[model samples]
Target chain A: EDKVVQSPLSLVVHEGDTVTLNCSYEVTNFRSLLWYKQEKKAPTFLFMLTSSGIEKKSGRLSSILDKKELFSILNITATQTGDSAVYLCAVRGGTSYDKVIFGPGTSLSVIP
Target chain B: SAVISQKPSRDICQRGTSLTIQCQVDSQVTMMFWYRQQPGQSLTLIATANQGSEATYESGFVIDKFPISRPNLTFSTLTVSNMSPEDSSIYLCSVEPRVGDTQYFGPGTRLTVL
Candidate 1:
């Protein structure tokens, strides 16, 4: 079975603080790892990490994958109240048609 | 990325009844996935609906309980059968674009069974 585990199930931080969320996976033939942000409805795509040691960034949110360690981390710098949401990590296996295995997610709350 | 939409954004159904949720995508997609999100939980894959074949269900899920239909590359439906309180959840439909691995999601159907 493909499994993905996330650390720090929940966190509380103030604005301007930085936070790092971790995700580790155990899957056969690992293909790619992705990060998503969910506020209320649908999850918004964040980053997709396919190669190790390479950082993918979009504004204040950036993520990097460590294939050697089978883990990934999402970093939110200068966090704002709007950044408070659930961060989800998902992984896809080789030969799978985008069938992603999702982690339990980390709930973040940013206080103003 | 593709735009996805789901019908019946929410509903409160009685036990023993069933609800069918619809999903429509703006463009053709190769894979459509159904997921269930229980309260305060992560999304669980229910099945993978292909264009011309039977949907492949994941472990702990069955066709009898969650019948799915994929009539074409741009549309699909998921029906929750024999509803119980346990069936109450947020059902989301996702589509992976033909050009990328990113999976876009619909607004989701929030079903609340009493």
Candidate 2:
């Protein structure tokens, strides 16, 4: 069974604070790892990490994958109230058409 | 990235009733996925709807409970049968383009069974 686990199930931080969310997974054949931000309805895509040590960044949010450790981390620099949402991590494995398994997710609250 | 549109954004249904949610993608996609998200919970894969085959269901999910139909490459439907309060959830449809593993999601349908 492919399973993904996220750490720091929930967190509360004031604006301008930085936070790091962790996600680790165990799968039969790992293809890629993806991150999403969910506010109320649908989850929007954030980043997809396929190679280790290489980081993908967009504005204040960045993520890196460590294939050897089978883990990944999402870092938010100078968080804002808008960043308060559930961060989800999912892993795609088995085959190219395999289903994605998601982590429980980290609930982040950025207070103003 | 593909754009997905899910119909019946939300609905409140009575117990034992069934609801069918529709998903339409702007572009043709090889694989479309359906997922269930309970309140304050992670998204769970319900099934993978392929263009010409029966949807492949995940563990803990059955075809009878969640029947899916993929008539084409860009459209699919998921029906939640015999609903109960416990069946209340937000159902989302996702599409993967070109098999790179990045998935784009539809806005989702919020179903509340009372």
Candidate 3:
């Protein structure tokens, strides 16, 4: 069975603090790892990583993948109240590479 | 990325009723999917809406309870049948413009069963 796991199921931090979320997976035919931020009902795509040793960044959010270790990390710098949300990690892998397994997610609360 | 939208942004229905949610993409997409998110839970794939074919459902899901339709490449629909309190959830549709592409999700429909 394919599965994705995330550490620190919940977290709390002050504004301007930095946080790192971890995701590890075990699946066959690993195709890609993706990160999404769910603020309300819908989840917004943040990053998709297919290769290792390379970082993908967008403003204050950055992510990296380690294919060899079968894990990925998402880092948020200088967090803000607006950043409080559930950070999800998903891995696209299966016999046909059409399956997407999501982690439990990390609930982050950034307080002032 | 294509713009995706879902209909009936939300609804409150009585038990035993059924609700159908529509998903439309601004541009044609190759793949579309339906997902369910219960309160405080992660997204669970319901099915893959294949154009001109029967929707593929995941394990623990059935076609009778959660029927899907994909008449074309840019549109799809998911119907939650025989609703119950346990069926109340946020239903989302996502589109993959092409094979191996990142998926973009719709705004989602919030359903509450009474």
Best by TM-score: 3
lDDT: which is higher, 1 or 3?
Answer: 3
- Interface RMSD of the predictions, in order shown? 0.7, 0.6, 0.7
Per-residue lDDT over A1-112 for candidate 1, one digit per residue giving the tens place of the 0 to 100 score? 6799999999999999999999999987888898999998788999999999999999999999999999999999999999999999999883455468899999999999
lDDT of 2 at B59: 76
Better of 1 and 2 by lDDT: 2
Q: Write down the C-alpha DockQ for each prediction.
A: 0.83, 0.85, 0.86
Predictions in order: lDDT? 0.92, 0.93, 0.94
Per-structure clash totals for the candidates: 0, 0, 0
Our tally of clashes for model 3 stands at 0
How do the residues A1-112 of candidate 3 rate in per-residue lDDT, one tens digit apiece? Answer: 8899998999999999999999999989999999999998888999999999899999999999999999999999999999999999999988655678889999999999
Ranking by DockQ: 3, 2, 1
Per-residue CA lDDT of candidate 1, range B3-112, in tens?
89999899999999999999999999998999999999999999989898899998799999999999999999999999999998999999998635888899989999
True contacts kept of 2: 0.80
* Of candidates 3 and 1, the better by DockQ: 3
